[model samples]
Target: MAPSWVNDRSYYQEDCPIYFATDFRQIRNSLSHADYRRINGGNRITLSEFYKQYHKYIMLLYQNGRELWSIQNIEKIDLGDVTEFNRMIFE
Candidate 1:
């Protein structure tokens, strides 16, 4: 069956992967704080990489409308407005 995170719409390409991530657990796991930064954090996405895979970049926010994580096609982005766009999505 398709992943529960994915709905019946093509929000992503054909079958983009879904991720359920957390910050507290990462801290407990001794992961670097950089990776755990909020979705609005700086360098959330790479310009060069995004341009290279411009056809596969999509982001989804979840969980109390707090988290912002990338989904499939996560390399392409014509829109450079991460904060504005994300705010719109989560707001």
Candidate 2:
């Protein structure tokens, strides 16, 4: 399956956070607390089922993670590039 981040050739578009964050929360909870359920809604799904749903989007998650890492490690904040920065963040 195609990665989820590329919606209309852009990132941070439709369903971006949900496509990654929900699965991350589910897996994190499963590993840390043995809470294999929907993180927000209290619905339950087996780990296998969660894996089936999540497997396809792994690349999406990885790409977003890398983007976040790059942003976090920035050495300087150039005010001149505010527009680009805003697009990177708020878009």
Model 1 Cα lDDT, one tens digit per residue, 9-71: 464545433321232233324334445433333434333433334323333333324433433
Cα shift from native, residue 59, model 2 (Å): 2.4
TM value for model 1: 0.17
Tens-digit lDDT track of model 2 for 1-91 = 5455444345433364354566666666766784524344356545666666665466567777787646543445555675467557754
Reference-based lDDT, each prediction: 0.40, 0.57
Off by over 4 Å in 2: 1-24, 34-43, 71-91
Candidate 2 residue 47 Cα shift, in angstroms, is 2.1
The superposed Cα distance between candidate 2 and the true structure at residue 9, in angstroms, equals 10
Give lDDT: candidate 2, residue 6.
45
Candidate with top lDDT is 2
Ten residues in a row with the worst lDDT in model 2? 8-17
